[model samples]
Target: MRKLANRPGGPKGAAIIRRGWGKVLGGLTLSPLMAVLLTPPAAAQSADISQKVKAECAACHTETGNSIALPFPKLAGLAPDYLAKQLRDFVSGARKNEIMFPIASQLSRADITALADYFSRQKRTPAMVTKPQLLAAGEIVFHQGNKENGVPACAGCHTRNGAGAPRFPMLAAQNPDYVVQQLQNFRSGARTNDFGKLMRTTVSRLTDDEIQAVAQYIASVPPPAGR
Candidate 1:
């Protein structure tokens, strides 16, 4: 047997190798093999929802609810309750969005719930802060509001790290431009979804510069680890 093994070129050598491989392969079960083939890659697992639903959302928010589009807000990592509320508002015309109103109006309550849950579980990519020069001014605005202008500190509602509370949004890693746009909308009364105009009143006293600075600062705040 030793001599036969040593002589690898022997006629039996080929059969021996095939037999060994067969024995090893025999140990693998069909379920495990199917799972290996069927499972999506780790990074892509976020799109576990139906392809139709994912495609619909992907057009604007992307499958993971993280989009680089400056106009769209990051939906990933936000509380499911908040997302669900926003969707319902859009559907009911409580939140006036020219683009989203039609699409959201068509969705059922279950669809809204599923999308909210799906996006909430997705990990959000970090936002890139433009105009780093404004960071200091932005930080001041975020942490300590301008008393002279009657602007309240953002940290009081958004938390020190901007992680936000139940109704408050998770502002960390949000696009600065989008943040600025929303503030402007609030101040201008173009967007009035905030309960009792809380955002409208809060931003009413903020100057254009202050709004920009605060947005820039918010972009600098990192999202929670692994989220």
Candidate 2:
């Protein structure tokens, strides 16, 4: 009788068969374990950042960064870079806010980054629209500048939906009163931190009516779905 070890498919074939079985067993045993070890749930990831926002920023900005107060700007969905820069400005006295100056002064660069990351991820609540009539004019100003007044379209930098770029800020769903105040500040030179005097030059040409129209339009922007 022929010996099994001396068969045409010899030790090499037997070894390959064993290796295949080992791989199958290893995959079945290790996959679930690896997933549990490597992948944390989303809630777990956000919990620490959520706690920090609650402790330091909830009083004025609210836990979600959607404050209803007129004086405080809604931080939800703001550009992270813009938020970080503003915080740094507060720390350096470039932006004067008695409330923010003290709070921001205490934060380290890492803390600022954490806060910016947290707030930028939050969903913004749309501010209620009070002036429906002005939406047309506001839309015009936002999408197309008045050539005669030398005013550039607000959407040129902020995007058509008001989702702003890295340095610019998201104006959608912002409080109208807050928007007006910032624009006025730009016009009056009270807020000089704007890069290249861009805001000042743009706001200077806007009439009071135009400002109001734009603010109302921005405030009326609907919140993103499922947010």
How accurate locally, in lDDT, is each candidate? Answer: 0.83, 0.85
lDDT of 1 by residue, 63-171 (tens): 7777788778888899999999999998887778888888888778867887888888889888888899999999998999999988889998889988888898889
Pairs with steric clashes in candidate 1: none
Q: In order, what is each prediction's RMSD in angstroms?
A: 9.9, 8.4
Sliding window of 10 residues with minimal summed lDDT for model 1: 43-52
Best by TM-score: 1
Predict model 1's lDDT versus the native.
Answer: 0.83
**Candidate 1 regions with alpha-carbon error over 4 angstroms:** 1-48
In model 2, the runs with Cα more than 4 Å from the true position are 1-49, 224-227
Ten residues in a row with the worst lDDT in model 2?
A: 1-10
